[model samples]
Target: MGGLEGEGPDRLLRSMVVADSRRGQGIGTRMLAALERYACGHKVLALHLLTNSAADLFSAHGYSRLDRCAAPDSISQTAQFSTLCGSSAIYLCKTLSVGD
Candidate 1:
């Protein structure tokens, strides 16, 4: 499962999870794709995520690692960045071509 935190152009991708039993089946990839489609439909220009793990999964899907401080306030102000995820968590982003 996965979710986005805001409706604005810059949004946070959070709460992504796949049960241990569901690993290695491409479910996470499918879920990410769906979320991207949903975000694009809502006019989101970029997606930001903090992951201590799964960076490879995201990177493979076009997300690039970035400095946490580089995140826009719209995403930096979210609880995911302020409190939930730690400083050590890897920050990644994907710029989407809306309506594509």
Candidate 2:
């Protein structure tokens, strides 16, 4: 569930979650770092995510909030963007380096 989507350099982080009971134990932080490392390994230039409640968490990890309209077609067309997450969901992005 933690992987990128889209064509070429337009990657999006499809899913990242941890059980509520396991939260605050650094799992999400570690998982996100690992996810970024994996994405970087595959040459993903940027990562995007949609969230309703974890904006603070993502922000703390270096993701910046973005307007929904800023999403490119590759992200806007996804089922997660069009249907899964609610309209109030926060859109976030971060540029990545191969060494990230």
Candidate 3:
């Protein structure tokens, strides 16, 4: 669901999905909450992810849309930034402040 920054400054949350049968059970929301906690605990400044169809879900979780053309340097080099995610892919960001 997420990657730790073993060799870099930021972590990557590549993919998160709940089984089809589990949809609407709040599992995805819980997963995202856990990921946010992990990021905050690790002192990560922000969390970045791309979604093709779950933009609403992310928005509900406090992530804001980011312009791909203006993505931050730290995130612009990620796989989601470079290839896996297409130009149409939605970029979302969430800042993790102290005590978050």
Candidate 4:
């Protein structure tokens, strides 16, 4: 799932879960790639996402961990930050160029 910024300028990617049976088949990677494509198409400047323990997966796809205290205001107010994910959840951001 994902949330788009006002008029879709930025996007917050959330919760990418492939069934355990489907793990290792590149489904999660494909989903994230699609979101990246969408964000680039919309001219988004950056994409943010919070993950509890999936840092490796995100890192592989170019996301970098952000210091929790320095998280963007928009990410701080997300439902994943406020409730769903734990306080120790890792915040990650990826800058996206308009093309490629």
Candidate 5:
């Protein structure tokens, strides 16, 4: 999908997953595309995620690693930031653009 002209729905994308049995069949990619499509419809400019897993996957898919302590307040103050995800968890972000 593409990016919207204004503000989008949610800024944070939490806990993306694929069952172990379905790990490498392009399902995750498709799912992510669908989610991005919806996000674009809502005009979300950038999306953020916190995870201890899938570093390479996220990186290859255009997400950039961010310092947990240096994350923006919008990201750092989330429940996943303070409680759900661990203190050492990796914070990553993908900036969405038109036609992206």
Candidate 6:
């Protein structure tokens, strides 16, 4: 899912999951692609997410590991950042282009 939270060039990629029974298929990737398209349409310049798992999947899709502190204030102030996800959660970001 996509969380169009905050007022900035970034959009939060809240969550993306494929059921264990549905794993190994391309559903998650397709979902991510669609989410990116939607974000691009909304003028989002980047997508960020905090994950303790699925880092490999995100990395495979071009998200790079980043320090959580590098997250913009718009992102860091969210409940997901401040309360939901733990301090050890991995932060990942992907810079987006208009047509991406």
Per-model RMSD to reference? 0.9, 1.2, 1.9, 2.0, 4.4, 1.3
Task: List, residue by residue over 1-100, the lDDT tens digit for candidate 4.
Answer: 4445433555678667778898788888888888888878888888887787688999998889988666666666767667887877888889898784
Deviation of model 2 at 83, angstroms:
1.5
The whole-model lDDT of each prediction reads 0.92, 0.86, 0.77, 0.76, 0.73, 0.87
| Candidate 1 C-alpha lDDT tens digits along 1-100 | 8899886799999889999999999999989999999999999999999999899999999999999889999888888899988899999999999674
TM-score of each: 0.96, 0.92, 0.87, 0.85, 0.83, 0.93
Task: List model 5 lDDT by residue over 1-100, tens digit each.
Answer: 2222223333777657889999898877887787777787667778787778777877888989988786667766777788888877788888888676
Question: Best-fitting candidate, measured by lDDT?
Answer: 1
**lDDT tens digits, residues 23-67, model 6?**
788888888899889889889999999998899999999999999
For model 3, the stretches where C-alpha displacement exceeds 4 angstroms are: 1-9
Better of 2 and 5 by TM-score: 2
What residue runs in model 6 are displaced by over 4 Å at the alpha carbon? 1-4
The superposed Cα distance between candidate 3 and the true structure at residue 48, in angstroms, equals: 1.0
Model 2, 1-100: lDDT tens per residue?
3667776776778778899899999998888888888888888888899988889998998899989999888888999899999999999999887777
Ranking by lDDT: 1, 6, 2, 3, 4, 5
Model 5, residue 90: C-alpha shift (Å): 0.9
Say which candidate scores most in TM-score.
1
- Candidate 5, clashing residue pairs? 8-42, 8-43, 8-44
lDDT of 3: 0.77
TM-score of 5: 0.83
Candidate 2 or 3, higher TM-score? 2
True-structure lDDT of candidate 4 = 0.76
- Tell me how far the alpha carbon of residue 54 in candidate 5 is from the true structure, in angstroms, after superposition: 0.9
Question: Is candidate 5 or 6 superior in lDDT?
Answer: 6
Candidate 6's TM-score reads 0.93
Return the TM-score for candidate 2, rounded to 2 decimals.
0.92
Model 4 residue 23 CA deviation (Å) reads: 0.8
